[model samples]
Target: MQTIGKIASVGAVAVAAAFSLTACGGDDTAAQPAAAPPAPSSSAAQAAQPEGRECTADDVKTTGNFGQAPTITIPDDCDPPKKLITKDLVAGTGSGAKAGQQLSMNYTLVTWSDKQKLDSSFDRGEPFSLHLGAGEVIPGWDQGLVGIKQGGRRLLIIPPDLGYGQGGNGIKANETLVFVTDAVAVPTDKS
Candidate 1:
Protein backbone atom coordinates (compact mmCIF):
# COMPACT_ATOMS: atom_id res chain seq x y z
CA MET A 1 0.00 0.00 0.00
CA GLN A 2 2.73 2.41 0.92
CA THR A 3 4.61 1.46 -2.20
CA ILE A 4 1.64 2.44 -4.30
CA GLY A 5 1.46 5.76 -2.52
CA LYS A 6 5.09 6.38 -3.18
CA ILE A 7 4.62 5.55 -6.83
CA ALA A 8 1.74 7.98 -7.05
CA SER A 9 3.78 10.61 -5.32
CA VAL A 10 6.49 10.18 -7.91
CA GLY A 11 4.00 10.71 -10.69
CA ALA A 12 2.61 13.70 -8.87
CA VAL A 13 6.03 15.28 -8.97
CA ALA A 14 6.11 14.89 -12.71
CA VAL A 15 2.59 16.27 -13.20
CA ALA A 16 2.68 19.11 -10.68
CA ALA A 17 4.45 21.43 -13.09
CA ALA A 18 1.72 21.20 -15.70
CA PHE A 19 -1.50 20.97 -13.68
CA SER A 20 -2.95 22.32 -10.52
CA LEU A 21 -2.29 20.02 -7.59
CA THR A 22 -5.43 20.85 -5.71
CA ALA A 23 -8.48 18.96 -4.40
CA CYS A 24 -6.45 15.76 -3.98
CA GLY A 25 -3.60 14.50 -1.82
CA GLY A 26 -1.59 12.43 -4.33
CA ASP A 27 -1.47 11.26 -7.93
CA ASP A 28 -2.92 8.22 -9.69
CA THR A 29 -1.43 4.68 -9.34
CA ALA A 30 -1.25 1.84 -11.91
CA ALA A 31 1.15 -0.62 -13.56
CA GLN A 32 1.51 -2.55 -16.79
CA PRO A 33 -0.66 -5.65 -17.29
CA ALA A 34 -1.26 -7.99 -20.18
CA ALA A 35 -3.48 -6.76 -22.99
CA ALA A 36 -7.12 -7.63 -22.51
CA PRO A 37 -10.12 -7.44 -24.89
CA PRO A 38 -11.81 -4.55 -26.62
CA ALA A 39 -14.66 -2.59 -25.06
CA PRO A 40 -18.20 -1.80 -26.26
CA SER A 41 -19.00 1.20 -28.40
CA SER A 42 -20.90 4.22 -27.09
CA SER A 43 -24.28 3.21 -28.41
CA ALA A 44 -23.81 -0.41 -27.40
CA ALA A 45 -22.65 0.47 -23.90
CA GLN A 46 -25.50 2.89 -23.09
CA ALA A 47 -28.27 2.09 -25.56
CA ALA A 48 -30.92 0.95 -23.09
CA GLN A 49 -29.90 2.76 -19.97
CA PRO A 50 -32.67 4.57 -18.14
CA GLU A 51 -30.74 7.82 -18.09
CA GLY A 52 -30.64 10.02 -21.18
CA ARG A 53 -27.01 11.00 -20.94
CA GLU A 54 -25.12 11.41 -24.19
CA CYS A 55 -22.72 8.56 -24.94
CA THR A 56 -19.11 9.40 -25.78
CA ALA A 57 -18.67 6.56 -28.31
CA ASP A 58 -15.83 4.79 -26.55
CA ASP A 59 -15.46 0.99 -26.69
CA VAL A 60 -13.63 0.10 -23.49
CA LYS A 61 -14.28 -3.31 -21.90
CA THR A 62 -13.19 -5.24 -18.83
CA THR A 63 -13.20 -8.79 -17.44
CA GLY A 64 -12.81 -10.42 -14.01
CA ASN A 65 -15.03 -10.36 -10.95
CA PHE A 66 -15.23 -7.72 -8.25
CA GLY A 67 -12.63 -7.70 -5.44
CA GLN A 68 -10.01 -8.77 -7.97
CA ALA A 69 -7.94 -7.10 -10.64
CA PRO A 70 -9.83 -6.63 -13.89
CA THR A 71 -8.46 -7.23 -17.35
CA ILE A 72 -9.11 -4.17 -19.49
CA THR A 73 -9.16 -4.42 -23.26
CA ILE A 74 -8.73 -1.55 -25.70
CA PRO A 75 -9.41 -1.94 -29.38
CA ASP A 76 -6.78 -1.17 -31.97
CA ASP A 77 -9.18 1.31 -33.53
CA CYS A 78 -10.53 2.64 -30.28
CA ASP A 79 -11.84 6.20 -29.93
CA PRO A 80 -11.57 7.83 -26.56
CA PRO A 81 -14.38 9.90 -25.08
CA LYS A 82 -14.36 13.61 -24.36
CA LYS A 83 -16.10 13.31 -21.02
CA LEU A 84 -15.44 11.18 -17.98
CA ILE A 85 -17.32 7.86 -18.06
CA THR A 86 -18.01 5.86 -14.93
CA LYS A 87 -19.45 2.37 -15.30
CA ASP A 88 -20.11 0.25 -12.26
CA LEU A 89 -19.26 -3.38 -12.93
CA VAL A 90 -20.20 -4.49 -9.40
CA ALA A 91 -22.51 -2.41 -7.26
CA GLY A 92 -22.19 -2.25 -3.50
CA THR A 93 -24.94 -1.96 -0.88
CA GLY A 94 -22.95 0.05 1.63
CA SER A 95 -22.94 3.82 2.06
CA GLY A 96 -22.01 5.87 -0.95
CA ALA A 97 -18.58 7.45 -1.06
CA LYS A 98 -18.50 11.18 -0.49
CA ALA A 99 -15.93 13.92 -0.90
CA GLY A 100 -13.47 14.59 1.94
CA GLN A 101 -13.70 11.06 3.33
CA GLN A 102 -10.80 8.67 3.75
CA LEU A 103 -11.06 6.01 1.08
CA SER A 104 -9.22 2.72 0.66
CA MET A 105 -9.49 1.16 -2.77
CA ASN A 106 -7.91 -1.47 -5.02
CA TYR A 107 -7.41 -0.43 -8.61
CA THR A 108 -5.75 -1.04 -11.98
CA LEU A 109 -4.86 1.63 -14.54
CA VAL A 110 -4.29 1.32 -18.26
CA THR A 111 -4.10 3.46 -21.38
CA TRP A 112 -6.97 3.52 -23.83
CA SER A 113 -4.86 4.16 -26.90
CA ASP A 114 -2.25 1.36 -26.67
CA LYS A 115 -3.68 -0.79 -23.86
CA GLN A 116 -0.63 -0.36 -21.67
CA LYS A 117 -0.91 -1.04 -17.98
CA LEU A 118 0.36 1.82 -15.82
CA ASP A 119 -0.16 1.00 -12.14
CA SER A 120 -2.22 -1.32 -10.00
CA SER A 121 -2.69 -1.74 -6.30
CA PHE A 122 -3.97 -5.26 -6.92
CA ASP A 123 -0.60 -6.14 -8.43
CA ARG A 124 1.04 -5.05 -5.21
CA GLY A 125 -1.34 -7.11 -3.06
CA GLU A 126 -2.62 -4.08 -1.17
CA PRO A 127 -5.18 -1.34 -1.26
CA PHE A 128 -4.30 2.35 -1.72
CA SER A 129 -5.72 4.85 0.76
CA LEU A 130 -6.30 8.54 0.18
CA HIS A 131 -8.45 11.47 1.17
CA LEU A 132 -11.25 11.78 -1.29
CA GLY A 133 -11.35 15.15 -3.09
CA ALA A 134 -8.05 16.12 -1.55
CA GLY A 135 -5.19 17.30 -3.76
CA GLU A 136 -3.65 13.84 -3.58
CA VAL A 137 -4.81 12.55 -6.95
CA ILE A 138 -5.63 13.65 -10.49
CA PRO A 139 -8.77 15.53 -11.42
CA GLY A 140 -10.24 12.47 -13.09
CA TRP A 141 -9.99 10.35 -9.94
CA ASP A 142 -11.13 13.21 -7.74
CA GLN A 143 -14.27 13.57 -9.81
CA GLY A 144 -14.94 10.03 -11.03
CA LEU A 145 -14.69 8.29 -7.65
CA VAL A 146 -17.43 10.18 -5.96
CA GLY A 147 -20.67 8.32 -5.07
CA ILE A 148 -19.11 4.87 -5.46
CA LYS A 149 -20.27 2.65 -2.61
CA GLN A 150 -18.14 0.50 -0.42
CA GLY A 151 -17.26 -2.85 -2.01
CA GLY A 152 -18.26 -1.61 -5.44
CA ARG A 153 -16.20 -2.02 -8.57
CA ARG A 154 -16.14 0.88 -11.03
CA LEU A 155 -14.64 1.45 -14.44
CA LEU A 156 -13.60 5.03 -15.07
CA ILE A 157 -12.74 6.12 -18.61
CA ILE A 158 -10.98 9.41 -18.12
CA PRO A 159 -10.25 11.84 -20.89
CA PRO A 160 -7.10 13.94 -20.90
CA ASP A 161 -8.82 17.00 -19.51
CA LEU A 162 -9.85 15.12 -16.42
CA GLY A 163 -6.67 13.06 -16.42
CA TYR A 164 -3.06 14.07 -16.76
CA GLY A 165 -3.28 16.65 -19.46
CA GLN A 166 -0.27 16.73 -21.84
CA GLY A 167 1.05 13.65 -20.00
CA GLY A 168 4.03 13.13 -17.74
CA ASN A 169 5.79 10.46 -15.70
CA GLY A 170 5.35 7.54 -18.09
CA ILE A 171 2.06 8.77 -19.57
CA LYS A 172 1.72 10.24 -23.03
CA ALA A 173 0.37 13.63 -23.96
CA ASN A 174 -3.41 13.93 -24.11
CA GLU A 175 -3.79 10.24 -23.40
CA THR A 176 -7.03 8.56 -22.42
CA LEU A 177 -7.02 6.41 -19.29
CA VAL A 178 -8.89 3.29 -18.23
CA PHE A 179 -9.24 2.55 -14.54
CA VAL A 180 -10.88 -0.41 -12.81
CA THR A 181 -11.27 0.43 -9.16
CA ASP A 182 -12.78 -1.47 -6.23
CA ALA A 183 -13.99 0.57 -3.31
CA VAL A 184 -12.63 -1.44 -0.41
CA ALA A 185 -13.53 0.91 2.42
CA VAL A 186 -14.74 4.44 3.17
CA PRO A 187 -14.23 5.20 6.83
CA THR A 188 -15.99 8.19 8.34
CA ASP A 189 -14.81 10.12 11.32
CA LYS A 190 -17.18 9.68 14.22
CA SER A 191 -16.56 12.57 16.50
Candidate 2:
Protein backbone atom coordinates (compact mmCIF):
# COMPACT_ATOMS: atom_id res chain seq x y z
CA MET A 1 0.00 0.00 0.00
CA GLN A 2 1.22 3.55 -0.73
CA THR A 3 1.47 6.03 2.09
CA ILE A 4 0.73 9.75 1.91
CA GLY A 5 4.32 10.75 2.47
CA LYS A 6 5.74 7.55 1.02
CA ILE A 7 6.14 8.79 -2.55
CA ALA A 8 3.43 6.52 -3.88
CA SER A 9 4.38 7.39 -7.43
CA VAL A 10 6.05 9.90 -9.72
CA GLY A 11 3.04 11.98 -8.82
CA ALA A 12 4.86 11.88 -5.53
CA VAL A 13 6.65 14.78 -7.19
CA ALA A 14 3.25 16.00 -8.40
CA VAL A 15 2.17 19.33 -6.96
CA ALA A 16 -0.58 21.81 -7.16
CA ALA A 17 -1.90 24.29 -9.75
CA ALA A 18 -5.36 22.99 -9.04
CA PHE A 19 -7.61 24.81 -11.42
CA SER A 20 -9.61 22.65 -13.88
CA LEU A 21 -10.23 19.40 -15.80
CA THR A 22 -8.30 16.71 -17.78
CA ALA A 23 -9.67 13.40 -18.98
CA CYS A 24 -8.58 9.74 -19.59
CA GLY A 25 -9.64 6.35 -21.08
CA GLY A 26 -8.72 2.79 -22.32
CA ASP A 27 -7.99 0.34 -25.19
CA ASP A 28 -7.36 -3.29 -26.38
CA THR A 29 -5.15 -6.32 -25.46
CA ALA A 30 -4.74 -5.61 -21.77
CA ALA A 31 -1.61 -7.15 -20.25
CA GLN A 32 -2.82 -7.89 -16.72
CA PRO A 33 -5.72 -8.99 -14.55
CA ALA A 34 -8.54 -6.46 -14.68
CA ALA A 35 -10.08 -4.52 -11.83
CA ALA A 36 -13.71 -3.70 -11.11
CA PRO A 37 -15.38 -1.12 -13.38
CA PRO A 38 -16.77 2.25 -12.28
CA ALA A 39 -20.46 3.06 -12.20
CA PRO A 40 -22.59 3.51 -15.31
CA SER A 41 -23.09 6.91 -16.97
CA SER A 42 -25.98 9.35 -17.39
CA SER A 43 -29.18 9.02 -15.36
CA ALA A 44 -28.39 5.37 -14.74
CA ALA A 45 -25.68 6.27 -12.22
CA GLN A 46 -27.89 8.27 -9.89
CA ALA A 47 -31.43 7.38 -9.11
CA ALA A 48 -34.07 9.19 -7.06
CA GLN A 49 -35.43 5.84 -5.91
CA PRO A 50 -34.50 6.34 -2.28
CA GLU A 51 -35.90 9.83 -2.64
CA GLY A 52 -33.22 11.52 -0.61
CA ARG A 53 -30.24 12.96 -2.49
CA GLU A 54 -32.01 14.61 -5.35
CA CYS A 55 -29.88 14.31 -8.44
CA THR A 56 -30.11 16.53 -11.46
CA ALA A 57 -28.83 15.38 -14.83
CA ASP A 58 -25.61 17.20 -14.10
CA ASP A 59 -25.08 15.31 -10.85
CA VAL A 60 -26.10 12.03 -12.45
CA LYS A 61 -23.59 12.68 -15.22
CA THR A 62 -20.64 12.39 -12.83
CA THR A 63 -18.54 9.24 -12.81
CA GLY A 64 -18.15 8.80 -9.04
CA ASN A 65 -20.42 6.51 -7.09
CA PHE A 66 -20.95 8.78 -4.11
CA GLY A 67 -23.77 6.61 -2.76
CA GLN A 68 -21.68 3.46 -2.79
CA ALA A 69 -18.70 4.84 -0.87
CA PRO A 70 -19.46 5.81 2.71
CA THR A 71 -16.33 7.92 2.69
CA ILE A 72 -17.95 10.06 -0.04
CA THR A 73 -21.21 11.89 -0.03
CA ILE A 74 -23.20 14.48 -2.00
CA PRO A 75 -23.67 17.19 0.58
CA ASP A 76 -27.03 18.91 0.67
CA ASP A 77 -25.10 21.90 1.91
CA CYS A 78 -22.98 22.93 -1.06
CA ASP A 79 -23.05 22.52 -4.82
CA PRO A 80 -22.45 18.84 -5.52
CA PRO A 81 -18.75 18.28 -5.15
CA LYS A 82 -16.68 16.88 -7.99
CA LYS A 83 -16.66 13.09 -8.34
CA LEU A 84 -13.27 11.43 -8.08
CA ILE A 85 -11.76 8.47 -9.98
CA THR A 86 -15.07 6.97 -10.96
CA LYS A 87 -15.40 7.36 -14.66
CA ASP A 88 -15.09 4.76 -17.44
CA LEU A 89 -14.30 7.55 -19.87
CA VAL A 90 -13.76 5.03 -22.61
CA ALA A 91 -14.61 1.40 -23.21
CA GLY A 92 -12.01 -1.34 -22.74
CA THR A 93 -11.47 -4.37 -24.88
CA GLY A 94 -9.05 -5.87 -22.36
CA SER A 95 -7.71 -5.26 -18.85
CA GLY A 96 -4.92 -2.66 -19.03
CA ALA A 97 -3.31 0.12 -21.00
CA LYS A 98 -2.10 -0.24 -24.55
CA ALA A 99 1.61 -0.94 -24.88
CA GLY A 100 2.68 2.08 -26.96
CA GLN A 101 0.34 4.92 -26.10
CA GLN A 102 1.79 7.76 -24.05
CA LEU A 103 -0.32 10.13 -21.97
CA SER A 104 0.82 13.70 -21.28
CA MET A 105 -1.10 15.08 -18.37
CA ASN A 106 -1.26 17.80 -15.70
CA TYR A 107 -3.07 16.94 -12.52
CA THR A 108 -3.88 17.63 -8.89
CA LEU A 109 -4.55 14.60 -6.73
CA VAL A 110 -6.14 15.12 -3.33
CA THR A 111 -8.31 13.54 -0.70
CA TRP A 112 -12.01 13.78 -1.44
CA SER A 113 -12.97 14.70 2.10
CA ASP A 114 -10.65 17.51 3.14
CA LYS A 115 -9.28 18.42 -0.30
CA GLN A 116 -5.68 18.09 0.78
CA LYS A 117 -3.34 17.64 -2.19
CA LEU A 118 -1.23 14.50 -2.09
CA ASP A 119 0.55 14.20 -5.45
CA SER A 120 1.29 16.48 -8.38
CA SER A 121 3.63 16.00 -11.31
CA PHE A 122 2.12 19.12 -12.80
CA ASP A 123 4.19 21.22 -10.44
CA ARG A 124 7.32 19.97 -12.19
CA GLY A 125 6.37 21.99 -15.30
CA GLU A 126 6.58 19.12 -17.79
CA PRO A 127 3.48 16.95 -17.71
CA PHE A 128 3.72 13.27 -16.77
CA SER A 129 3.17 10.13 -18.81
CA LEU A 130 1.55 6.82 -17.97
CA HIS A 131 0.17 3.86 -19.90
CA LEU A 132 -3.53 4.40 -19.91
CA GLY A 133 -5.60 2.18 -17.64
CA ALA A 134 -2.55 0.16 -16.68
CA GLY A 135 -2.01 -1.31 -13.24
CA GLU A 136 1.25 0.62 -12.93
CA VAL A 137 -0.92 2.82 -10.74
CA ILE A 138 -3.78 2.77 -8.25
CA PRO A 139 -7.21 1.37 -9.19
CA GLY A 140 -8.60 4.86 -9.72
CA TRP A 141 -6.20 5.47 -12.60
CA ASP A 142 -6.88 2.04 -14.00
CA GLN A 143 -10.64 2.40 -13.95
CA GLY A 144 -11.25 6.07 -14.68
CA LEU A 145 -8.80 6.37 -17.55
CA VAL A 146 -10.88 5.69 -20.61
CA GLY A 147 -13.01 7.49 -23.24
CA ILE A 148 -11.00 10.67 -23.01
CA LYS A 149 -9.83 12.67 -26.01
CA GLN A 150 -6.46 14.31 -26.19
CA GLY A 151 -6.12 17.76 -24.61
CA GLY A 152 -9.15 17.22 -22.47
CA ARG A 153 -9.69 17.72 -18.76
CA ARG A 154 -12.04 16.00 -16.34
CA LEU A 155 -12.46 15.60 -12.59
CA LEU A 156 -12.49 12.23 -10.85
CA ILE A 157 -13.55 11.26 -7.37
CA ILE A 158 -11.90 7.95 -6.58
CA PRO A 159 -13.65 5.79 -4.05
CA PRO A 160 -11.47 3.48 -1.93
CA ASP A 161 -12.70 0.43 -3.81
CA LEU A 162 -11.14 1.94 -6.93
CA GLY A 163 -8.30 3.34 -4.89
CA TYR A 164 -6.35 1.95 -1.94
CA GLY A 165 -9.51 0.33 -0.57
CA GLN A 166 -9.80 -0.92 3.05
CA GLY A 167 -6.08 -0.89 3.77
CA GLY A 168 -4.66 2.36 2.45
CA ASN A 169 -0.96 2.99 2.23
CA GLY A 170 -0.54 5.65 4.91
CA ILE A 171 -2.71 8.75 4.84
CA LYS A 172 -5.55 7.47 2.75
CA ALA A 173 -7.36 4.50 4.18
CA ASN A 174 -11.05 3.99 3.87
CA GLU A 175 -10.85 7.34 2.09
CA THR A 176 -12.08 8.74 -1.20
CA LEU A 177 -9.70 9.82 -3.96
CA VAL A 178 -9.98 12.98 -6.02
CA PHE A 179 -8.16 13.94 -9.20
CA VAL A 180 -8.47 16.62 -11.86
CA THR A 181 -6.46 15.79 -14.94
CA ASP A 182 -5.65 17.13 -18.38
CA ALA A 183 -5.09 14.58 -21.14
CA VAL A 184 -2.63 15.99 -23.58
CA ALA A 185 -2.29 13.26 -26.17
CA VAL A 186 -2.99 9.64 -27.11
CA PRO A 187 -1.59 7.97 -30.19
CA THR A 188 -4.10 7.37 -32.89
CA ASP A 189 -2.97 3.77 -33.12
CA LYS A 190 -0.37 1.78 -31.19
CA SER A 191 -0.07 -0.91 -33.83
Candidate 3:
Protein backbone atom coordinates (compact mmCIF):
# COMPACT_ATOMS: atom_id res chain seq x y z
CA MET A 1 0.00 0.00 0.00
CA GLN A 2 1.26 3.46 -0.83
CA THR A 3 0.19 6.68 0.81
CA ILE A 4 -0.96 9.70 -1.20
CA GLY A 5 2.26 11.44 -0.24
CA LYS A 6 4.27 8.64 -1.73
CA ILE A 7 2.35 8.79 -4.98
CA ALA A 8 2.29 12.57 -5.17
CA SER A 9 5.99 12.77 -4.43
CA VAL A 10 6.57 10.98 -7.69
CA GLY A 11 4.78 13.40 -10.05
CA ALA A 12 2.74 16.58 -10.10
CA VAL A 13 0.31 15.20 -12.68
CA ALA A 14 -0.58 12.30 -10.40
CA VAL A 15 -1.14 14.70 -7.56
CA ALA A 16 -3.63 16.71 -9.57
CA ALA A 17 -5.49 13.63 -10.71
CA ALA A 18 -5.62 12.04 -7.29
CA PHE A 19 -7.09 15.11 -5.64
CA SER A 20 -9.67 15.58 -8.35
CA LEU A 21 -10.82 11.98 -8.49
CA THR A 22 -13.20 12.11 -5.53
CA ALA A 23 -16.34 14.17 -4.96
CA CYS A 24 -15.39 14.88 -1.35
CA GLY A 25 -12.80 17.62 -1.87
CA GLY A 26 -12.85 20.71 0.30
CA ASP A 27 -10.57 23.60 1.15
CA ASP A 28 -7.52 22.91 3.29
CA THR A 29 -8.92 25.32 5.83
CA ALA A 30 -12.16 23.48 6.36
CA ALA A 31 -12.86 23.42 10.07
CA GLN A 32 -12.20 20.24 12.03
CA PRO A 33 -14.49 19.55 14.93
CA ALA A 34 -12.73 19.34 18.27
CA ALA A 35 -14.16 15.86 18.67
CA ALA A 36 -16.43 13.46 16.83
CA PRO A 37 -19.93 13.14 18.18
CA PRO A 38 -21.20 9.85 19.60
CA ALA A 39 -22.57 7.59 16.85
CA PRO A 40 -24.01 4.36 18.21
CA SER A 41 -25.61 2.04 15.65
CA SER A 42 -27.71 -1.11 15.23
CA SER A 43 -26.54 -4.21 13.38
CA ALA A 44 -29.75 -6.23 13.35
CA ALA A 45 -32.65 -4.87 11.34
CA GLN A 46 -32.81 -1.46 12.91
CA ALA A 47 -32.64 -2.89 16.41
CA ALA A 48 -32.45 -0.48 19.33
CA GLN A 49 -29.43 1.83 19.61
CA PRO A 50 -29.14 5.40 20.83
CA GLU A 51 -31.91 7.97 20.91
CA GLY A 52 -32.44 11.72 20.20
CA ARG A 53 -30.68 11.80 16.85
CA GLU A 54 -32.91 12.94 14.02
CA CYS A 55 -31.79 10.03 11.84
CA THR A 56 -29.79 6.81 11.87
CA ALA A 57 -28.14 4.76 9.12
CA ASP A 58 -29.36 1.50 10.69
CA ASP A 59 -32.75 1.75 8.94
CA VAL A 60 -31.06 2.06 5.58
CA LYS A 61 -30.76 -1.39 4.04
CA THR A 62 -27.65 -2.49 2.19
CA THR A 63 -26.70 -5.53 0.14
CA GLY A 64 -23.08 -6.32 -0.53
CA ASN A 65 -19.87 -7.56 1.01
CA PHE A 66 -16.82 -5.79 2.31
CA GLY A 67 -14.26 -4.66 -0.32
CA GLN A 68 -17.00 -4.29 -2.97
CA ALA A 69 -19.47 -1.63 -3.90
CA PRO A 70 -22.66 -1.84 -1.84
CA THR A 71 -26.21 -1.43 -3.03
CA ILE A 72 -27.77 1.18 -0.79
CA THR A 73 -31.49 1.52 -0.37
CA ILE A 74 -32.62 4.58 1.50
CA PRO A 75 -36.12 4.63 2.92
CA ASP A 76 -38.34 6.82 0.75
CA ASP A 77 -39.70 8.57 3.80
CA CYS A 78 -36.49 8.80 5.74
CA ASP A 79 -35.72 12.16 7.24
CA PRO A 80 -32.36 13.81 6.98
CA PRO A 81 -30.38 13.62 10.18
CA LYS A 82 -29.33 16.79 11.92
CA LYS A 83 -26.03 15.15 12.81
CA LEU A 84 -23.68 12.69 11.15
CA ILE A 85 -24.36 8.99 11.85
CA THR A 86 -22.10 5.99 11.40
CA LYS A 87 -22.51 2.24 11.79
CA ASP A 88 -19.93 -0.48 11.39
CA LEU A 89 -21.62 -3.10 9.26
CA VAL A 90 -18.54 -5.36 9.24
CA ALA A 91 -15.79 -4.88 11.76
CA GLY A 92 -12.20 -5.34 10.71
CA THR A 93 -9.25 -6.62 12.70
CA GLY A 94 -6.24 -4.32 12.40
CA SER A 95 -4.80 -1.07 13.70
CA GLY A 96 -7.55 1.57 13.77
CA ALA A 97 -7.16 4.49 11.35
CA LYS A 98 -6.25 7.89 12.71
CA ALA A 99 -6.02 11.43 11.40
CA GLY A 100 -3.21 12.31 8.95
CA GLN A 101 -2.67 8.75 7.76
CA GLN A 102 -3.35 7.99 4.11
CA LEU A 103 -6.43 5.82 3.57
CA SER A 104 -7.51 3.97 0.48
CA MET A 105 -11.01 2.60 0.09
CA ASN A 106 -13.89 1.69 -2.17
CA TYR A 107 -17.12 3.57 -1.62
CA THR A 108 -20.54 4.23 -3.09
CA LEU A 109 -22.49 7.42 -2.52
CA VAL A 110 -26.24 7.79 -2.83
CA THR A 111 -28.51 10.72 -2.30
CA TRP A 112 -30.84 10.07 0.59
CA SER A 113 -33.70 12.17 -0.70
CA ASP A 114 -34.02 10.59 -4.15
CA LYS A 115 -32.21 7.31 -3.63
CA GLN A 116 -30.05 8.00 -6.64
CA LYS A 117 -26.48 6.90 -7.10
CA LEU A 118 -24.11 9.82 -6.86
CA ASP A 119 -20.58 8.42 -7.15
CA SER A 120 -18.49 5.31 -6.55
CA SER A 121 -14.84 4.39 -6.57
CA PHE A 122 -15.76 0.75 -7.20
CA ASP A 123 -17.44 1.73 -10.45
CA ARG A 124 -14.20 3.32 -11.53
CA GLY A 125 -12.28 0.13 -10.81
CA GLU A 126 -9.92 2.03 -8.53
CA PRO A 127 -9.71 2.77 -4.86
CA PHE A 128 -9.88 6.35 -3.63
CA SER A 129 -7.06 7.52 -1.39
CA LEU A 130 -6.76 10.60 0.77
CA HIS A 131 -4.96 12.13 3.73
CA LEU A 132 -7.48 11.65 6.52
CA GLY A 133 -8.74 14.68 8.46
CA ALA A 134 -6.91 17.07 6.18
CA GLY A 135 -10.00 18.56 4.55
CA GLU A 136 -9.27 16.56 1.43
CA VAL A 137 -12.80 15.16 1.83
CA ILE A 138 -16.09 16.09 3.38
CA PRO A 139 -16.32 16.85 7.08
CA GLY A 140 -18.54 13.87 7.81
CA TRP A 141 -15.99 11.51 6.31
CA ASP A 142 -13.09 13.16 8.11
CA GLN A 143 -14.83 12.76 11.45
CA GLY A 144 -16.88 9.61 10.96
CA LEU A 145 -14.17 7.33 9.59
CA VAL A 146 -11.51 8.15 12.16
CA GLY A 147 -11.41 4.86 14.03
CA ILE A 148 -12.45 2.39 11.29
CA LYS A 149 -9.94 -0.43 10.97
CA GLN A 150 -8.61 -1.74 7.70
CA GLY A 151 -11.16 -4.01 5.94
CA GLY A 152 -14.12 -2.66 7.89
CA ARG A 153 -17.40 -1.81 6.19
CA ARG A 154 -19.22 1.23 7.52
CA LEU A 155 -22.39 3.12 6.72
CA LEU A 156 -22.47 6.89 6.88
CA ILE A 157 -25.53 9.13 6.86
CA ILE A 158 -24.42 12.72 6.36
CA PRO A 159 -26.64 15.72 6.62
CA PRO A 160 -26.17 18.87 4.51
CA ASP A 161 -23.87 20.42 7.05
CA LEU A 162 -21.47 17.53 6.78
CA GLY A 163 -22.10 16.80 3.11
CA TYR A 164 -22.15 19.21 0.21
CA GLY A 165 -23.44 22.05 2.34
CA GLN A 166 -25.29 23.89 -0.42
CA GLY A 167 -24.56 21.10 -2.89
CA GLY A 168 -22.13 20.98 -5.81
CA ASN A 169 -21.18 18.88 -8.82
CA GLY A 170 -24.56 17.13 -9.43
CA ILE A 171 -26.00 17.19 -5.93
CA LYS A 172 -28.82 19.54 -4.98
CA ALA A 173 -28.92 21.95 -2.07
CA ASN A 174 -29.50 20.62 1.41
CA GLU A 175 -29.41 17.06 0.18
CA THR A 176 -28.65 14.34 2.67
CA LEU A 177 -25.97 11.80 1.74
CA VAL A 178 -25.70 8.06 2.31
CA PHE A 179 -22.36 6.39 1.82
CA VAL A 180 -21.33 2.75 2.10
CA THR A 181 -17.57 2.83 2.51
CA ASP A 182 -15.14 -0.04 2.82
CA ALA A 183 -11.92 0.62 4.69
CA VAL A 184 -9.87 -1.29 2.17
CA ALA A 185 -6.42 -0.42 3.39
CA VAL A 186 -4.39 2.09 5.31
CA PRO A 187 -1.16 2.52 3.47
CA THR A 188 2.22 2.36 5.16
CA ASP A 189 5.77 2.79 3.87
CA LYS A 190 6.65 -0.68 5.07
CA SER A 191 3.86 -2.32 3.12
Give me the candidate number with maximum lDDT. Answer: 1
Per-residue lDDT of candidate 2, residues 19-126 (tens digit)? 111122122211221243345465533531244442332342323321111121243323322234344333323223344355665555665444456555455444
Model 2, C-alpha of 52: deviation from truth (Å):
6.6
Q: Against the correct fold, how does model 2 do in TM-score?
A: 0.50
Q: In model 1, what is the error at residue 166, expressed in angstroms?
A: 2.3
Deviating ranges (above 4 Å) for candidate 1: 1-58, 188-191
lDDT tens readout by residue for model 3, 1-191: 12222222222232221212243333332222223323535442253322444556777899999977799987644456788889999998677788899888788888775578867878877787777876566667778888888889999887877666544345555667888889889754343
Q: Residue 43 of model 3: what lDDT?
A: 45
Judged by lDDT against the true structure, how good is candidate 1?
0.67
TM-score of each: 0.71, 0.50, 0.71
* Whole-model lDDT, model 3: 0.65
Candidates in descending lDDT order = 1, 3, 2
What are the lDDT scores of the predictions, listed in order? 0.67, 0.42, 0.65
Sliding window of 10 residues with minimal summed lDDT for model 3: 1-10
* Candidate 2 local distance difference test against the native: 0.42
Q: What tens digits encode model 1's per-residue C-alpha lDDT throughout 28-62?
A: 53332224345757865663233433334246678
Better of 1 and 2 by lDDT: 1
